[model samples]
Target chain A: MTQARTLYDRLWDDHLVVERPDEPALVYIDLHLVHEVTSPQAFEGLRRRGLLVRRPNRTVATIDHAIPTHDRSLPIADRVAAGQIEQLKRNCTDFGVPLHGPGSGRQGIVHVIGPELGLTQPGMTVVCGDSHTATHGAFGALAFGIGTSEVEMVLATQCLLQRRSKNQRVEVTGRLRDGVTAKDLILALIARIGVDGGAGTVLEYTGSAVRALDMEARMTVCNMSIEAGARAGMIAPDDTTFQYLHGRPFAPSGRAWDEALERWRTLVTDDGASFDRSVEIDGDAIEPMITFGTNPAQAIAIGGRVPSPTDVPAADREALTKALAYMGIEPARPILGHPVQTVFIGSCTNGRLSDLRAAASVLRGRKVHPGVRTLVVPGSEDVGRAAEAEGLADIFRTAGAEWRAPGCSMCIAMNGDEVRPGETAVSTSNRNFEGRQGRGSRTLLASPLTAAAAAVTGAVADPRTFA
Target chain B: MTPFIAFESVYARLLRSHIDTDQIIPARFLKTTSREGLGRHAFADWRYEEGGQLRPDFPLHHPSARGATVLLAGENFGCGSSREHAPWALLEMGFRAVIAPSFGDIFRQNALKNGLLPIAVDAGVHAALADAPPDATVGVDLGVIRLPDGQRAFYPIDPFWKACLAGGIDEIEYVLRQAEAIADFEQGAR
Candidate 1:
């Protein structure tokens, strides 16, 4: 008998190569993306095994994390870092995988390039050596991050042995209020669910609120799913998704497009399909939220205060206290109006053109507050070009924010752009864990508008006031 | 020869979801290339102060957590960033096994490579581990895990990976053992 199935189950079952009922099943991968940070060891593993990548056509490579965004010249200043990048290029060439290195117009963050080049599409199983691989789920694909050994495994076998996750439906209904963008919506979701809310599930974001978001915005939401402890996040494909794929470099055209769309249309969860868990939120109720403490879940509305430890669950009270103590925040204190030393408006989470345009709208005539350093790093070369064409870079520069080249900059501090010790930053990136931005550096996660406002005010201020 | 896998028994209680790589080993500790000494720095930010002294306020630093090895972490336990240092630090910290509802793809592979067995238990089992005391002891077989109270669960492991782990074999050793098979196949195909 045919059983009712959700989109996740359909995809899971289709990809399953070996099903050992009680054990993880080996699922096939449609695409494998590699980058500088995690590819080194996997290549090393391959070298140790004296094995070539079995399926070079299915693999792609890029350099972003450790490569200096400003300097593209060879022999990077940091010898060790330079070696890793060089090794990756060599490995990609050796393995016959396409490598988008510096100066390659296509070169950018793996997540950014994937969609722009139409490499990410619906119903495909995409694996990358980066956590934000979930960003591709914006296209209705089953994408997740893997490690070096898994990279090697995919190289050798083109499959991953994974246990299926229960499906979840996070329905954000109603139209978003004006000035509330995708970043705000995701921050609001994170706030409601806490960082670990969607654990053990694949969150299928649906409803009018999700459908209304553009492709870039959808990516922003899915990119932060890892922050919510979700295995991955996805949205049902629609006209918007198909339109974004049309005429792209790697996307199919003509008959293939028709075929792909037909398949994608069926990629949505069946109407009667049940979810392990479901949550509903009103899009109108969401305001620009910002994280107050270390975890993304430690967030509140832009005008809200740092929650008192007592207000939190007893089990989480200690963590709140520690985060507050480490952040130099007090219980019940207003965090929105708290001052910040810097503003970072970039990352795989919110580094697309739309994100920059949204931030640019807020910074048009305003200047970044004196003593607050602001930086805007685009997600990719294409995004950077698009922003520059729209004069978004001019607005940022005029506002005293440094517009940087494409790379994962202050996002993880893997590169040199890091928040100084003990200084607080309002960032549009994911993860506010201790030392995530830098050692002893404090991070407050917020929407791009909120970060822009913090740049202008030198403090975390409500963006709604400026709006 | 089989790989020299240094096996040790661990019994750590699980931390809730989203234990990111940054938290596994902070950025400051990432300056060095050598994987040695990472165990002491594992969870350094959450475990101790700048002076290397234990943070009295930290939960894992409490007396109750002493000698714990097997960690039962929440779902998506090593989510965010593919920093191999995370698994390196966890393994070096003397954690022989990590049981979670789900593990970040890269973190799981790195854990396995470093001889830190990542066991995926049911959501209920994970919640139980989180609710259990820090001193709760759990047994970690290759793909089967037994909780402190004797509840047992079996998780799937790739057969190829299972053989490697069972024989205490590293990736290189596994490849070497199959060299003859690979050569024979290549010759026949040609």
Candidate 2:
């Protein structure tokens, strides 16, 4: 009899093209998502080697990381960024790859566009140069990030040499409390397990709490898997997954959809399957969490006090001290009521339609604090248009927040959307690393609701209090 | 990629945990299409002050760290972001290998592909090396890393990657050698 296998095992086995014992196996890739930042060197490598893209149809391109979020009507002001974007357009056109460039209506963040366009499907192996490619695993795809060389490899050949990762189950039991969110749950998990806790593993998020999350929420959870040092994160395909992908642009239609559903329904962990490492978290206990330090794992519940260096283990003291110093926060201080100069509510992590709705729920009929500057950027043009149609854009604009176009603005600090030095920003982006937003800029990672609360109050405040 | 051979050099000790790619090479320096000359900007935030003056107290600029080709770092080195520029910059800065307790998954892959070895040692060995003098030397020969404590620990690496590093073989050409197999797999998949 065949041994019971987890969803990860099935996906890995199905994608294996050539097995190499004691080494990484050759695996076929069903989708290759490319962007301007990581694709230039890769395409240059292909050109240098006289290699053509093997499967242009299976490849998709977009411009996100370095594109300006404001005023696309004018020429790109940054010459280097404009050159890179122009290079991408030329490369895509030359190689016959489809590019959703600016004005394409589908232009947006790579991870956001993939699922919204229905390119990410269950049981498919998806890869992108960006680490948040784990975001695709929300649909049960064996998706992960690759380097530029690997990107070149995948471009020349629609396959990659990859090692099979061990299975790690992050099962959250019970329902999340009111005002808690997928962002809070993920931060809580990362805080419980350190930054490198899930190294060399693929995390399969399961249990009642995970199953109850909608597609966008699940994407938020999986998007930060890399922050926990996991190679990938996955959730088994279910009705929620199916419903999200049903009418997407690239989704199968008619008989194809029926066949796809039949196959997707089988993409779950078998009973008696065991994980290499497992951790259980009580979803009911997870409150709204906010990062007080540089790494995602340096998070604590909003009501908790900043941990003193002495309170931590000796091994952790140095990191704690460094983090506290960089964040300009003293140990033993309460995280709540901490002043924030800026509030940002968007990224691959929390820039979806529901994310916008959650933020607008808190911002409706409320003006942002005069002391704080707020920016609300959508994940894609599609998301931007939908938000406009729903009046979410109006709410953000009326609430004294700048409603910008879709792109990865301020998240990477590459597109001139950045917090000034020494300024504290309560952001909805994933990472809280030093200078992540800008040089000497202090970041406090939070959920969209919490970020909106901070914008309105100009300090770190509980979203439940807003409710 | 250049072939990596057995060698020893002065090790730089920047023993901070979770040194992410952004810290290695900030996003502002990433607008260039080419991967050349990123070493100047590696650890730009830490290496320089606001006015572009080198911080004398920075680890890389310290007297002991000058000319160092090996980095003795803390756990989870090269976390966050899949920019291969992190490895490219380190290699360009003359770092041949990094010894740490742990490494970020994507960073380790990128380092290996670029001929920069990432040696993940046990806590005991890492602490021993970390406690050593800043200018002390370390050796990496094939799969084994020689610590100053006289401990020769063998690090794990895929045989294929090991050979690739040793030979500086182009991975694309190697994979293309099996085009027939890939085509067959695609046929069966369809």
Candidate 3:
């Protein structure tokens, strides 16, 4: 008898090596990504144990968070940050793991570098130390974030003992209205399901709306699954996925590609496969979204009014009130056209070539308000090069925006690129918590196009108007 | 080595979910490699002014919440970044136990190593505790939590991690102490 299966079951069964009752199962990792921020301690742990990386070929390292994008030369100003970067290089060199250092052309955010290099393919298990590792799920992989200890485990064993997660399918149907992008769709999903909606589950995003999105857009949707407490988020491999993987550096070639496609064809959930829980939303109902408070879930449609504390459940009212007071936002007021002092467009979430092109389309022949400071940091060196070659950089510069090199610049502000205190920025990066950008900096999360529009208008303006 | 878990008392209600490491201790405060004195800056943005004076608006700095050791937080606590300073600052701030519905995987591991008890309670119970008065005293027994209103509930904890937290043993020390047992097990299997 043929076994009935879901995509999660198929992937889990394929990766499982050893299973013990009441104990975690050892599942193999197909790909491992490392970065400067989280790998130093893991490497130290390995050295202390006198173990070489069991499979260095399976791992790839990059420097992103702490590397300054503005100055790509040696001698980073921050001594501690420079040491962390130096330690990562030494560790990768000692272990035989490939390192994509600053200005390496391949160097960028670990999440962005993985997909662009074609190292992340469909139906593979990808693990990284960064939570945004879910970005690889755009290729229909089971990618999740691991801790430093788990990173060390993967380095030594090429496997992790993990408890399986339940399956969930979030079906988003109907065409997304113009001005709405993948970023908006994800924000709406979090708002509807709450932050912990998919806890202990692997979410499979399905339906026409998902299928219609490009790989970059799909990545933006899956990248925030961790924010929703999901183990990972994925979409079924389709023509778009195959096309995106066809010419990449590490992607399978010719006959090998054919064989890979044959396997990927079988990677979808079977008909009638039941999910532990499911949710359905009309994509048309979602508008451009902007976060008003700390949590990603504290968002509403761009043109929509801020929610009153009374509108929320009594149990959650106090938190809502606290968030409003901290953000200095008035409840029941429209967030549309709120004045912003700065705008940032880049991150693992939406710093791909397509994201840049989309923002450039809105920015062309327009100038940013003189009062506003707009920064466009590409996700990786490869993305930065591609955007510059495509004239997207010129368009951004023409529009009074600062076109910068690739690094996780202004995204969480660990690299010294930060929004000034109390300055509200329309940001494309994830997380808008107080001081998330800098101490006392206010962030309003939006799509790249919306951020571009905000930069030009010096306020939170609708991107659809430009479209 | 006997596990020397020293449980401190926290006297305030913790904030909600996604209390990320950045908020626990801002990036500016992370320039030092030494893990000492981070506790004083725990929740620095919310707890103090730019001038380093305590902010009266902060929940932890409130007069009613003084000297409270057991902190009750919302679900998916510590949800962003793998900064160990988060748990370090919490431990230094005298938070012995953090009771929440869930915890970020990295933060949970970091907390265990730092002798901070991360107690995972039911979501409904967490909600009830969040609704509890800011000054309400809740006892977080690693085994069970007793509410001020006489309501008591048992919470599930991973026994291995539980032993470590109770003994104040970290993974490195635990593995070192069990070296003989591990060696014996390997020999017996061979």
Candidate 4:
């Protein structure tokens, strides 16, 4: 008899292209997503080698990281950023790859476009030059980030030499309480595990709370898998996965849809399958969470205080001190009500339509704090239209937030939009790394609802108060 | 391109953990596709003051640490974005090997592809090496770390990766080496 297998194992095994004697097997890719920041060199390498993109139809390109998110009519102001965006368009055109450029109504963050267009599906193996490619694993796909070198290899051959990572399952039980969003849940997980906890491990988030989340919420969780050092994060395909993919543009149709559904039905983990490691958490124990330091791992519940240097291990003291110094905050003090000069709600992590709705719900009647400049950049053009259709943009605009075009605006500050130096921002993007938003800019990462609450109060306020 | 069989060097102990790729090679220096000019930019933010003077406190700037080819980084070195530029910049800076308690996966792969060795030693070995006499020369092999006193500790590595370093071959060569086997698998699957 055969041993039981996990959904990851099933997907990985199915995609195996060729097993190598000593290295990991080279696996075939089903969908390859490309973007501006990381693909320029990969494409240049291909051109250097006189190689052609092996599977152009399977690949999709978009302008996100380097493209200006405001006033698309005008040329990009920064010369270097403009060149990166232009290089991508030239590469995609030369390589016969479809591009979602400015005015395509499809241009957006790579992670957002893949799923919103229904290109990401259960059992598919996806690779993107960007690390947040793990976001697609929310649909039970075997997705992970690759460096630019690997992107070149994939573009040239449509396959990757892989060493399979050990599977580790994280189970969240019970239900999340009001005001506790997916962002809070993932922040708490990273804090518990530390930054290197998931190193070399493929994290599978399971149990009732994961099942309870919608597609966007699941993406929010999987999106941060890299933050915990996990190679990838996934959830098994189920009713939510099927319903979400049912009518999307790239989803299978008619007879093909029935066949696809039948196949997806069998993509669950077998009852007796074993994972290398397992973690169980009480979901109700989580609260609206925020990161106070340079790394996403240095986080706490909103009601909690910054961990004193003494509270950490000896190896962490210097880092904690540097983090607190950089953040310009005192240790051992309550994190609540810290002043924020800016508020941003967008990124591959939390820029979906659902995230906007959550923020709009809080800003519907309230005005933004007098001292704060607010930005509500959508993840994709599609999400932008959806928000406008629902009058979410009206709420943001009426509340004095700048509702702008879709892209990774202000998330990594690659575009012209940036949080000025010394300004503190409560942003919904992943990665609170030092200087990530802008040089010397302090960023406190929180859920959109928390960010919205902070926007109105000009401090880190609990969303529950608004509730 | 001979195998990276063994080497001995006084390790530069830069023990800060989670030194992400962005720090190793910041985005500002990433515009150029070629890896030639990245050496001077490696750890630009940390190794130099904003006004372009070297910070005497940084280990790389220490009087005796110059020309040290091996790097002793903290746990989770090369985390964050999947940039090959991190390893490219390090290699350009004359580092042939990096030793750590852990490493980010993509960075390790990138290092190997460029003939740079990423050694993941156990915590005991890492701590001992971190505390190794400031000018002590430590030996590094495929699966072993040799102390100055001729004692050795073992660390696990894939035989294939060992052979890749040993043979000085890239992934393309590895694939070509298995061409016949791959063809057989393809035909059978069809």
Candidate 5:
């Protein structure tokens, strides 16, 4: 008989290539997702070493970070950006790696396209160079972000030397109330635990609330796990995960589907399995949340007030003071009704069909505030086409928001889509770090619904008010 | 990769927590393919003012902290983004190690692979290091740090990584050595 093991334990055991005492375990990688920005240098490393990508068939490449999201038909205007994208294209062609470039209908954010194309599945190990690669963990895979060095290592050997991380279970009990979203729940969790709460741990999001979330919402919750400083965040695969992956292009088919489901069903943690650390939150008490400072931990409910720096610990007062000063927020004032200059609705975090639909629902019979500049960028071309088919794009355009192309637009500001300095943006993307949206840009991290409400109200407002 | 060497250097202290990769190397400067010449742009936003001049108030620019190769940072240093450029910029700027209470997991890995040591110290030891004068020399050897006061602390690192650092060996060759085992794993995985 074996001791009760966690989902992470199972995944680790299954992927172990070489495990020895006094050394990092070498684990096999199932899927490797590459993008232009991080892969150029990694490929250069490979070229310099005279090495070949060990498993080109298991690797997929795409352009999202440095490619222009708008008017893909036109040539990329920035020389450096063009060079990076072209470099990835040439590398993919030369290395026999599959690429979903501009013309490929599969082209989109790497994290987005992975799940949509079903390359990300249960009982697998996924690695990418972007931190948001943890977004795929929603499918019960042991996925994580690696640096360029590890990226080159993976390309060269299809394996990574890793130390096993401690297990931390983040359990959200009960059901989330109406208007409270996955994004809001994650924000509230980060606020409660602080930024480094999950350091050196792999978080298993469990309990009734996490299980109740749909596939897209689950991805949203896992997407921001890095913001909480977790090595990775995962949810056990169940019916929702199976249903989402069932018929996608890369998913198992026919007889293979039955076999895959059998293995996925066993991916859950066994009863009485214990974690090294645990945090429990009441989901029903959560409200639509927003960030008041640069880090995600400095968040508040939509109706809550910006906390006073003096009220925090002496050690934390300085950070709070600097954050409040940078964000231009008055302590103890309600975060609501603060004016926003831009509203961006896209990223690996929330740029999905359901997220766009939720935002479109808010703009169906309403117009955006005249003072607000709203950019509605989908996560990928597949998401864009689906939203267009469902008339969500029309609602956004009719409400005065720009329905742009599919890519990681203002979320990264790498493709010339940016919030100007000194401007405030209400964004659904994860991370509100200084200059994340743009230099000197003040980003208020929120849900799609909250971002949509701000788009129409031209200020920070509760999505429940519109509801 | 450069071999990790034991050396003594004055440590520069920046106690701001959650010092993210975005601050270390902003996204705007990430367009380049080459990893060279990034030291000039390291901490570009904080190190430089609006007119392209170095900010006088920035701690790294202080007279006593100049040319320091070791950085005493705050908790969760290198917290955001998995960009290897963060460690690259730090190395280029002559920083051989970062001492902190904690580090973002990915950044710690990136630093070690690039020969930039990430040393995790307890809050008490970290506080003492922080209070040390910028000009006080600190010693760092294999898996151990010697503070300005001569108090020693041993840090934890994987034996394999420590060996690689000591030998200045590229890990790719190490991984390549196990290609047959990797292929065997793939065969069984299928």
Candidate 6:
């Protein structure tokens, strides 16, 4: 019998075009996702080199990261952003690469659209210029981010030269309690392992808790895999994965579906497959976590105290002190009741229909606090339309939050949405780096329920209290 | 394309960990199509004040690091974002290499293609260089990096990337040179 191989090993073996020792491995790519910000330079490089796209059909492009979510019907006011979007359209049109530009019903965040359209499938090697391409790992794919130069490489050759990563399995056991979410689970893991814990490794999040999460929740978990500094992450494909893939726009149907499913069933790690490192987390113990600093790993439970420097290991104390100073929070103080000036409820991480529903459940009959500016930005036009059809948009608007179109707004702050200086925002977006939302603005990362609760209370409050 | 002939250069250090790409070259700085002149905006947030004026307190202006061509960074340098602008900014600013205990995977890959050498040493070496004085002349010759006290530490690099640097060729040039092999492989794959 062949040696037991983990899902990562299997994907690596199958995708390997050529592997010469001590040189980067030439690997075939199944999917190449592109967006405005990183693709311009890449396409420009190809043009400069007198190259044509080797596999245009394998690439999908979208306008995100800089597109205005508030007013897409009008001309983009920012000359720089307008120019970037125009360049992307020009490049796509010139090169025959299909683009989901603004006003295309399919236009949305690249990560969200890829899976929703069934472009992401089991056992494929998917890459994008954006780091959160790890979101596609929910389907058991070997997905990761590539730099712009690599983006051009993929465009010209439909393959990338990669150094294989080791396998790390993060197994979360037990059942999740109420008020806890996939966002909380990932945040807790990052906090437990530190930011660099997953470095140089592809994390396979296994165990009962991970398997229980639906495709959307699984995407949320995998979306932040990069936040922990992992090269990529994946889950074993199963019934839940199949259910999500079924009837998707790009998914196989009829006899092809049965055959695809059979192949997908074999995508799991074998029973005795080994990982370079293994970590265990108690899923039930994870609470709605929130970061009080400039990094995603600086997190604590909703009811927990802002940790004192003395409370942490000596090596981490200095960063803790610096974080506390930047956030204007006292060490040893309870994080609850800290005032929030803005609340954001979407991104590629938490912009799915289920994420909107989760936030809407809390906002159905509640109104945001008078002091807070709240935004419920969807991840895609499809997601936005689906939310509207489900009355989620009405619920958000009735509760005093701005119901904005889908794009990566407020998350990167490159778009029109911004958290003003000195204002604290409880956001559902990934990343909490300094000036991530805006220069001199502070950020607190939370799940949808927790963000909704913060919106209503105008402070960091327990979602369970509202529940 | 300039061949990387290892040489001693001016150096400076950022004594903090997890310096992300967003911190290196913020999103606003990414508006330009041309990669030229990003060197001036390298670490713009910290190098300049909030109001867009140069801050006097920043060590970038210190006499010792004024024209520093190498950077000593804390662990996990270039942590966030897959933007290659981070390396372009560093290279444009005349940084030949960055010495750190560890680096973000994407940033490291981007640096190699752009001729910015990412030199990873042991954490102990990083600690030793943590106090590297201003006006320091660090030494790098092939795999070895020498510190202020004349201590030399070697680093491991991908042989392919090494060859590219030595030949002063980017991936495109190398890939074009292999056109026949690529065509042969494409025919087989099809």
Highest lDDT model number:
2
Give the per-residue lDDT digits (tens) of candidate 6, residues A96-186. 9999887889999999999999999998989999999999999999999999999999999888888889999999999789889999999
In model 5, where do residues sit more than 4 Å from their true spots? none
Error of 6 at A398 (Å): 0.8
Q: Of all true interface contacts, what fraction is found in model 5? A: 0.79
Q: After superposition, how far is residue A70 of candidate 2 from its true place, in Å?
A: 0.7
- Decreasing lDDT order of the candidates: 2, 5, 6, 4, 3, 1
TM-score per model over all chains: 0.86, 0.99, 0.91, 0.95, 0.99, 0.98
Which ranges of candidate 1 are over 4 A from the true structure?
Answer: A20-23, A73-75, B1-19, B27-41, B44-79, B98-113, B118-190
DockQ of each: 0.31, 0.83, 0.27, 0.48, 0.84, 0.64
Write candidate 1's Cα lDDT for A1-467 as tens digits: 16778878887876766565655566777889988776666777677768888679879898888766665664567776777777787888788999887778888888999999999989888999777888999988888877767787788767666778889899999988877878778878888886768767888999898999999999999998877777789987889999999999999898988988888888878768899999999998887788888888788887777789999788777778878988988789788668799899988889999999888989999999998999999999999999999899999999999998898889888778889989999999988888998888999988888899899998888887888
Model 4 Cα lDDT, one tens digit per residue, A1-467: 29898778888888887775766888887899988877888888788778788779989999888777778898888887887777888998899999988788888899998999999999899999878899999999999999887888888777888888888899999999989999999999999998878888899999898999999999999999999999999999899999999999989999999999999898888999999988888898999999999889999999999999999999899999999998998999999989999999999999999999999999999999999999999999999999999999999999999999998878878676778878899999998877778666789999999999999999999999998
lDDT by residue (B122-162, candidate 6, tens digit) is 98788777766666678876578998888888888888888
Candidate achieving higher TM-score, 2 or 4: 2
In candidate 1 the C-alpha lDDT for residue B138 amounts to: 66
| TM-score of only chain B in every candidate structure | 0.81, 0.96, 0.81, 0.90, 0.96, 0.91
- Pairwise TM-score winner, candidates 1 and 5: 5
Query: In candidate 5 chain A, where is summed lDDT lowest over 10 consecutive residues?
Result: A64-73
Docking class of 6: medium
Error of 3 at A249 (Å): 1.2
lDDT of each: 0.80, 0.93, 0.82, 0.87, 0.92, 0.89
Better of 2 and 6 by TM-score: 2
TM-score per candidate for chain A alone: 0.97, 0.99, 0.98, 0.99, 0.99, 0.99
Please state the error at residue B114 of candidate 1 in Å.
3.9
Clash pairs detected, candidate 1: A23-B156, A24-B156, A147-B106, B10-B69, B10-B70, B11-B69, B11-B70, B12-B70, B14-B72
